[model samples]
Target: MAHPVDVHVGQKLKQIRTLRRHSQTDIAQRLGLSFQQIQKYEIGSNRIAASRLFELAQIFDVSPAYFFEGVNGANDSEVTPCNTSTTISKALAAIEDETVKTRIVTFIEDISGMAVGRQG
Candidate 1:
């Protein structure tokens, strides 16, 4: 069975990669590995080395610790979707109609009272 820490890290990896809109092949090419290897890493079937993790951090423009965030408190029940902000950002980006996009943003801002803070 995959270790919890490994699963968490893999989840983080997939989340960030999806947020950046990079295909598995893109990352695989940059790392000089096969897409299958990337898939394995994303599924927690293979553990990432510390050195490779550092490389991934560089590619994603985040700190190495980013992959480990929320690990301590995470449980199977907490294994939900990617970060809400990331999902919202992706959805907003996909809207081709400016008017619809604006309305969606306005709705969110209105309901949120324009509050700015880290999401839980």
Candidate 2:
């Protein structure tokens, strides 16, 4: 059986890949891996090495902390912090409509502006 952490990471990878609008073949090519390897990684059939995870973070344009979101370290007692930014990124991926993307971007910009105003 695959470890829970591996399974979670794989799911996150798939989600990120889908959000980026990349096919398995595309991601495989970018990673210099076979499509089968990408599938295996997405399904948690294969464990991703630390270096490979770093590669994936770069490919996904997300911080490494994104993968650790909702993850409890090996100690099982130390739960990593949840990164809300990743959730936004994932949501952005599921939106296929260009108008929706534009709207979301505008909304985010507005919110950021408000935050900056508050800070100032």
Candidate 3:
């Protein structure tokens, strides 16, 4: 089975690639990989080497850590081993319509307010 962290990184990689309007073929060509290989990397079916990951980060113009942005257990101080960032990132990535994105943002804001109210 693929590791959860690897899966999360793969999801993030796909999300960033989509957000940047880069196609699998385009990215693969740049990396000198087959599109199928890119797909595997995006789907977490294959483990990306550290060196290749660095190369990907360059292609995306981000640090290698960017691929692990939503991954949990990155820090020792964070309470609850939850993939909060990953969840949010995935949710946002699924919203293709701008109007839907606006509504989702509003909903999140309202939910955040409710949580704060409960705390207060």
Predicted candidate 3, C-alpha RMSD: 7.1
Tens digit of per-residue lDDT, candidate 2, span 6-102:
7778778887787577899998998899999999998778999999999999998899777766777666544453346557777787788999897
TM-score of 1: 0.67
> Which pairs of residues collide in model 2?
none
Residue-pair clashes per candidate:
0, 0, 0
- What overall lDDT, based on C-alpha atoms, would model 2 receive against the true structure? 0.78
Pairs that clash in candidate 1? none
- Which whole-number lDDT from 0 to 100 does residue 116 have in model 3? 58
Cα error of candidate 3 at position 78, Å: 13
- Each candidate's lDDT (Cα)? 0.82, 0.78, 0.76
* TM-score for each predicted model, relative to the true structure: 0.67, 0.66, 0.63
Candidate 2 stretches with Cα past 4 Å from truth are: 73-96, 104-120
Instruction: Summarize candidate 3's per-residue lDDT along 6-59 as a digit string, tens digits.
Output: 676677777778767688999999999999998998777998999999999998
Looking at candidate 2, the ten consecutive residues that score lowest on lDDT are 77-86
- Superior by TM-score: candidate 2 or candidate 3: 2
Could you tell me the C-alpha RMSD of candidate 1 in Å? 5.5
Residue 71 lDDT in candidate 1? 63
